[model samples]
Target: MLTAAIVAILVTMVLALIRAFLGPTEYDRMLAANAFGTKTVLLIALAGHALSWHSFLDVALLYAMVNFIGTIAVMRFFEYGNTRDNEGSGSTP
Candidate 1:
């Protein structure tokens, strides 16, 4: 039963990864990537239980935090249109 669940999550993660790569828009890609991350967390947790490895849970938690922060940072970057300026610029406003 646990094996089946893990397999299903893995399949969905693959689908999400495809969507992230082939999505029509930036938002769609980001959303798909987010879904992929979520599925990954689920997969890690399930596999950890199935294999009796407790450390996987901690790794999953860390991955979740990174995923959330990365999504937010990407969104902000798109919205702000590159807030970081190049150092080669000769003048500052």
Candidate 2:
């Protein structure tokens, strides 16, 4: 059961990667990338369960944090043109 869930997540991750590569608009690609990151978290957790590796959960947690931060950073760049120096810009600061 867990293996099936892992496989499904991997399949979705592959599709998301295709979308990221083929998306016409920047936002479309960003959305796909975000979805890919989310799927990666799920895959890691499933692998942890299947392999009985407790450390995988820790890695997954870290990956989730990084994914969230990365998505926010990307969106901030799209909206403000820079991740740094968004101070007082009112768009992302």
Candidate 3:
């Protein structure tokens, strides 16, 4: 049962990767990437269960945190133009 679930998740991850590659807009790509990250977390958790390793959950939690932070950074970068030159540029007020 668990093996089947893991396989399904892997399939979803592959589809998400395809979407990330073929997305027409940056936001669409980001969304697909985020979905892949989320599925990765699930995959890790399932693998940990299948292998009887308790440490994988911790790794998954850390991955989730890092993924969330990266998504935020990407969104901010798109919104603010650039992290280093957002304040001093004379494009607008």
- Considering every candidate listed, which one attains the maximal lDDT? 3
Q: Which model is ahead, 1 or 2, in terms of TM-score?
A: 1
- Badly placed stretches (over 4 Å) of model 1 are 83-93
Q: Model 1 Cα RMSD, Å?
A: 2.9
Rank candidates, TM-score, best first.
3, 1, 2
Compared with the true structure, the alpha-carbon lDDT of candidate 1 equals 0.90
lDDT of 1 by residue, 1-93 (tens): 988898899889999999999999999999999999999899889888888996999999999999999999999987876645755687776
Task: Choose 2 or 3, whichever is better by lDDT.
Answer: 3
For candidate 3, lDDT tens digit of each residue in 1-93? 999999999999999999999999999999999999999999999999999997999999999999999999988877777656656776775
Q: How far in Å is the alpha carbon of 76 misplaced in model 2?
A: 0.7
Score each candidate by Cα lDDT: 0.90, 0.90, 0.93
Give me the overall lDDT of model 3.
0.93
lDDT of each residue in 32-72, candidate 2, tens digit only? 99999999998888888888996998999999999999999
